[model samples]
Target: MIIDLRSDTVTKPTKGMLDAMMQAKVGDDVFSEDPTVIILEERLANMFGKDRALFFPSGTMANQTAIKLHTNPGEQVICDKYAHIYNYESGGASFNSGVSCRLLDGNQGMFTANQVLEAINPDAFYYSQTSLVEIENTTNKGGGACWNFNEILKIKEVCKSNNLGFHLDGARLWNALVAKNESTKQYGDVFDTISVCLSKGLGCPIGSVLIGDEDIMKNAIRVRKIFGGNMRQVGYLAAAGLYALDNHMERLNDDHTKAKQIGEVLSNLSYIKTVEPVETNIVIFELHEGVNEKEFVQKLQENNILIISMGSNILRMVTHLDYTNTMHEKVLEILTSLKF
Candidate 1:
């Protein structure tokens, strides 16, 4: 069987999820008349102790909306240098929000409150005013490392003292929550806006939810409309989100367990240089200097195993609902028997 380890976004809906989507009562979501979408939003909002949640078509759109809500044009966002917002979002912050990111050097994509405090620009007109601080939980580029909840609290204090808005790119926050045993309310107590992705880890076909207090989210729908994210009868997708919340959340630990298993195998391999500590579903590792990245990937492809190359001798594999124990075993076997 061909195994796809590229991302959790590749997961297809289960039969049960498909049934839910087929049975979902849908309406025009642009006018807030979709019953299923409304329930999904309200359920997520209450879970995080937030006043409201708005749905979007993608994690990037949800996150970009949060940035727009918190800052004016020309203001800057302070975030980790490895942030997905900077690396993967196609510069939506600068394109849509007119905000530049002031990136901080942090361990495994998690920075200290002191780092955020130090990165904030002064009130002087010469500098781009630091209007917001954004962070990604379970940082993707840093090998899916989860942030310390205490450090997030510390960062929030600095933002509060400086009157800066706080935002979370929680695309993989479900992984962090399961790995760290963190409660949603704890995050609600910190960030001004939180973007959580249902497409990743949760096994939803598509959708992300942006959560915030009512005042912060009041203009969100309008912004989403301007971004061309407004949808009609989108409750069909939101139904899958609701189903995943009920059935797919706790199973994430299985993906984590499997990822750590992969990391264990990589660490023992001779050609492997380093395996980034696997806390959740993503496993990132580097090859020895002389190892050919292209040949390695091509070899795996020949075996019908697929993964991603992050260039510079680095490779990434992601565990997901679709990556079964059988596929995991086959992949590990191939990895163990590969000849240089």
Candidate 2:
């Protein structure tokens, strides 16, 4: 049995989720006629207390569409240097929106309100207009660290004062809500737009929902279509998202527990130099000098376990719905016994 701990996005649909998809009532979603897609959008919008929501094929598309909806070409978006919108989206922020990013030096992918104030470009003809502020919850490159709620509120206030649009890249927000004991409506009230992923912590095969007020969402729909995210018969995927929302959210805590268990084992190992804080389902650690990173990963793969290197000496493991109890136990046993 292969234990794929590379990412939550690697999870296959559970039997129940697949059943829901099979039974879904599908119609052409480009025409807004797919009943299941409409239901999923409404469900997410209501949960976040937003006026509307639009579904996309991936979190990247959802986020890129939101950026375009919020800003015109040549404007700047402010976010942490480690943000997915900056680092992982393959320059979609620049290519899709034609806007540059003003990156802040933040702690674990979360920038403070004060930092936002400092990063905002002065309104001048020579400077790119700082038109949007984007934040990530359970920051991916930050070892899945969650932003403090108070800090988020303070940054929202800064956005309002600066007359800048705000967006949240809440890809792993289900994990954040579980870890931080926060409410969905709180996020809805703060940001003008939010991009939430169903494939990440929620275990859906494919989908992300962008939430906003009616006007912003309508603009997002047009941007999404322009980005080639419009789909036909997408209700089958939407049904999996609905199923995941109902069944998989609460279980995210279990993945967090497994991540912590792995962290503990890593902490006790001699080869590990540092373990970034385990906040949600992602555990990231650095190896000591002289420890071959490639060799260590190969050894784990030889044992039927898989993980990913996050460049430098850092490695990452993400637990998800597909990482069963038996697999976790086996991984724990292997980790504890490893010589390197």
- Over 4 Å off, model 2: none
TM for every model, in the order presented, reads 0.99, 0.98
Score residue 78 of candidate 2 by CA lDDT. Answer: 94
Cα lDDT of all candidates, in order? 0.95, 0.93
- State in Å the error of residue 200, model 2: 1.3
Question: Model 1 has how many clashing residue pairs?
Answer: 0
Candidate 1: worst 10 consecutive residues by lDDT? 113-122
lDDT of 2: 0.93
lDDT for 332 (candidate 1):
94
Give the per-residue lDDT digits (tens) of candidate 2, residues 1-340. 9999999999999999999999999999988899999999999999999999999999999999999999999999999999999999999988988999999999888889999999889988999999999999999999999999999999989988999999999999999999999999999999899999999998898999999998787778778888899999999999999999999999999999999999999998888999998989999999998889999999999999999998888999999989999999999898888786
For TM-score, the strongest prediction is 1
Residue 78, candidate 1: Cα error in Å is 0.2
Q: Give a tens-digit lDDT track for model 1, residues 125-201.
A: 99999999999998999999999888888998999999999999999999999999989999998888999999989
